[model samples]
Target: MSFSSVSPSPTNHHQMTEDEMTSENSLLADRLHAMLHQEFTSYPACPDYTSQADHSSTCSPHSRRAVVNDDWRRKICEWAFGVVDHFEYSREAVSLTMNYLDRYASYAQSKGMPLSRKSFQLAAVASLYLAIKLEGRNEQGQRLTISTLVELSRGLFSVELIEQMEREILTALRWKINPPTAAQFIYHLIKLFPVEGIYDVDAKRVCNGILETSRFFSELSVYQSSLAIEQRPSIIAYSCILNAMELVGPVTLPCDVRQAFLTRIAGITQLREDMMEVYNTRTSLRELHSAITDAECGLPGGSSSDANQGTYDTSMLASTRVSPVCVSGRQ
Candidate 1:
């Protein structure tokens, strides 16, 4: 990027006025983002649909996801039951360090390298460095000793390599990551009206976006399942990581992450087909009302209690995925 890209312009960065800072920061990051995204191997930019979408006249999208499809199945595999397994593993210092690293991300985005906000993979410190940086205490406001970070990052990137890779990683993400995350998806999904909302002049889309993203999530899960088969962790864990970013807000993807997602997509295509099966049936309006009454009151002859228990996911992803956006923070 041009040095001017990093520097403030007279028209833009005249001073640190709130309005000026906001605009300048946005423009600067745009420039840096443009520079970083020069090399993207763009593929068909659509969700594979996990074969969740039926081709036959027999099955409709509504019937597919509404009735037999297992949304919880995927959500459960990744985040763990009733708990955030990842956060549990994190130390206070670790969270503080991630926050600290994120501070740098804000700094990077504000200054002109939208890199940090765009590519979280680029944001990861080496596993070792990350551990130390995340959870160390020294009187000097130091967390994770420097020696520790160095030891972890050493193989990933040498002192010299760290500089280049850091820049490159950020650059790669600028090319691929986009805003609107899975949490956003879940939010809209949960808030979704039974009917599609439309404004004739413009046409508004809501859970529609998640339609595509849902497919991606399914594909991601199937692919991850294979890679992580009885290994360190499931590939689905990465999906959880990405989804957590959504939970935290803002979705950025490193170019590497994009490639990884796509690779998983291919692997998942087969797996998803095998794992997901579509049925061609739907309850009539009367049938639906009866089922709803039975489910709501826990009436006899209803779907079993065990069936309803799956809805207890506290990840926020579960509760909100089917609803439309309410007031922001999930209650």
Candidate 2:
């Protein structure tokens, strides 16, 4: 099938020919398909504790109690994001860190022995430290050292503790260190949108803004303990993108074009089969985005400025450390 073609935008100093566009789109479609398959295959089993409402509050193997409640987990997530931001690491590191953390928690809970708050904190630190090594680099392209991470823990944890916890986390996760992040899925799925018609200046800017806004939701999803634990990354990414479109597409896109884009995204993600799941997730994200907007602007009950109109400045969140790192047996 012949792919749709478009006039080159000024942003492209060199434009691809029709054949190049076709080949690139074909390659992207293949990668997207592969990712969709892989996302579901090795997905970590959600802890029984996460899904149940009444078993027991004790952190037992058969208990329905969560190893870490969402509020505490959210704080740790903020701290981890701060660590990555301070170290100039990619935000993807934060995503990987959380993946390790959630999966290990599930593993522990499944074994009838869940981690305590202090133990969970230690595990979180170790997971962040390990994820940095796997995903980050300094100005000199050097990975962060264990000693540095230990120091960042306010000397609460020793090098031995961090090292040992790293091994335990890796074992619990069965060394699946590279779980697909929602951000990875976002970039791939964005390519499925037809590039042919969005070359106009306003259209291009609005489209780019949609992707950026979607990325904001994807990052925020990392802070949501249940979203990633319950949903596949592909679904989360798709839902985020769709949410962004609902917020921005109507502003700049013609009705027909917006509908086409919506249709295209649904086809790419197979939204028909998972309509209810995606709808629920999108509703959650919409509420999340609304709450963030209100919180950012200090509004109580009314809508404030919309970050979806343009790119959101996440540097404030990156710099804010919510709480101290709790160490096991610390005063």
Candidate 3:
């Protein structure tokens, strides 16, 4: 079930001229921004249930028995990351999976139905399964099958049960499965802000590095419920880029230019405080970058050595968890 062997090599697009590349990047950025705006207006919140009584039992009559705290939620997401990494699913898949879990949990809570601890992992797995189908594919360009997913889960679930859970999740979510994820926003943002004055070759390399590193941080953000649920995906993506820029230590923009860029990002996301909170507290950019390098360079025994390697050992990532002080502050 390991996806390591089937991982696709990076595609080269060197045939495109600089102007054409910029045009393509700009078009993509516009599309992503438009999609985010559309989602914001159409699904201001997770789709609502048809009836109040339709709320999950764990969030209703058994509400008192369904008290899962943020720490517990973080642990569940961490475990999901382990599952995602072990199977080599895309980071987008994992982030989108957590988005479903969080939004559904939030919607249920709003309806006075909080999920019980016992059912949380089921929801996580179902969300993961759905996200893989939505955002991941095998070398043969086919989505992972239920049997493969079941085996990946170490036989903890059967095909029938997982299918049932998936249906329940979709029902509970009111079929609003496609939401803007941090990774999506980050991809667009990187295109919008290219490295200045570099040749096409070097610019592409630097841009890809920033995108990959920002994506790692964005994936890590999924485990921090306070940040993930509270901030818009664009805000999270913007913060990640800023952190990535810091780590990459590229040429600094002029003060006024930097201020203008921040202003533009703030206006787009409209969650400046949340963005700053994410930057200052929710993630340690330096430590995360180090962990990614360690995982890539095989600092951890038998880890993958490919520079473009996306999957990493969950153990290496566990050390890069958000600071306890940040978690306490959120509480």
Predicted model with the maximum lDDT: 2
Q: What TM-score, computed on C-alpha atoms, does each candidate reach?
A: 0.25, 0.80, 0.65
Q: Native-vs-model 3 lDDT?
A: 0.60
RMSD of each: 20.1, 6.3, 11.7
Best by TM-score: 2
Lowest summed lDDT window (length 10), candidate 1: 276-285
Clashing residue pairs for model 2: 61-112
Candidate 2, number of clashes: 1
The TM-score of predicted model 3 comes to 0.65
lDDT of each: 0.30, 0.69, 0.60
Can you write out model 1's per-residue Cα lDDT over 1-331, one digit (the tens) per residue? 5455476777665555668656754564454333223312221112222122222213665554432112322232222211112222322222222222333333444455533111322243422233343344444453544333334333433455444544543463342333222222223322221222332211122223323333233223222212211111112222332332232211222234334433433342221212211110011212332453455521122122321321111221222122211111123
Reference-based lDDT, residue 317, model 1: 22
Clashing pairs in 3: 59-113, 59-114
Candidate 2 lDDT (Cα, whole model)?
0.69
Using TM-score, rank the candidates from best to worst: 2, 3, 1
Candidate 1: regions farther than 4 A off: 1-156, 173-176, 193-305, 309-331
* Candidate 3 or 2, higher lDDT: 2
How should the candidates be ordered by lDDT, best one leading? 2, 3, 1
Per-residue lDDT of candidate 2, residues 105-152 (tens digit): 878877877776677788988998888887757555878788877777
